[model samples]
Target: MLIRFKSPVAADVLMLGDNAQQLLRLVGREGQLKGIFEVDDQPHIIELLDAAVAAEAQAAEAAADAGGKAPARPLVSLRQRVWPLREMLHQAHRERVAVVWGV
Candidate 1:
């Protein structure tokens, strides 16, 4: 179950179901198979996503620094996972395009 986000402003962004749900919740959206994001919501969502990515990176770094085997090697760094969404959101905000998941 992959979530594919589509918009006129950019190419589709795909995520695994779990990753997609996590992102949806992270962005304060309904974590459902299908949902819509209004153009006006993109900026705030992007902001939150940015914060989440930073937080995750910091956590991973801390764990590594503690000799906890984190190694700064996240199997799925939120930054990498969330980047396409950010790109899509930025494009949507600039173009007034709506983004949809599971379309």
Candidate 2:
């Protein structure tokens, strides 16, 4: 299972794999593989957290704009949101999801 980011903020991470050459070769050969890899170099954890925060904020704002009552609490608290991203990275690593070289 490859993990691709919609943004290119993660390209720097491509350098961290022990098999960079093979990973790059695989990534280059398959368009589907390319879609799973993030071009952004940032750590997946940070990027994921940032994305989640942004998404949550957008959702909250949209709900407010639609005249729906903003939640008395955040839709997902910061703590609740942080772990999944890290867990995903860990799972991806353990599963060899993308031959991840970068953190």
Candidate 3:
């Protein structure tokens, strides 16, 4: 199965397994596994999510500045900011290793 979440202000998150490779292959590109972790490790997931949010914020600001408009406000709330990472833990493949976040 393939799962996707379209964020209002950031890149979309796509989740899928090897069985779904054919669908991705139709685009003439190979999909790479970026990072995967266990659900029991909350801290690791939190850090990854935080870094993603920060990066999104920075990109939005850069784009806005380049366009001569005010920077876009962060779409993530304080609470929801942590939700995606946590959700990833649950959704991630059990055999995958954790990707630690940079402080």
Q: Name the best candidate (by lDDT).
A: 1
Off-target runs (Cα >4 Å) in candidate 3 are: 3-36, 68-103
lDDT of each: 0.87, 0.44, 0.44
Q: lDDT of candidate 1 vs native?
A: 0.87
Q: How high is each candidate's TM-score? A: 0.86, 0.34, 0.34
lDDT by residue for model 3 (36-76), tens: 23335535545555665576667777888898776546554
- Evaluated against the true structure, the overall lDDT of model 3 is 0.44
Query: In each prediction, how many residue pairs overlap at the backbone (N, C-alpha, C within less than 3 A)?
Result: 0, 15, 0
Instruction: Give the Å shift of residue 87 in candidate 2.
Output: 16
Ranking by TM-score: 1, 3, 2
Q: Clashing residue pairs in candidate 3, if any?
A: none
As for lDDT, the candidate ahead, 1 or 3, is 1
RMSD of each: 1.9, 12.2, 11.4
lDDT of 1 at 80: 86
Kindly list the per-residue Cα lDDT of model 1 for residues 1-103, writing each as its tens digit.
Answer: 8889999889999888989998998987755788888998888899999999888878877897998777556577788889898999999889998999887
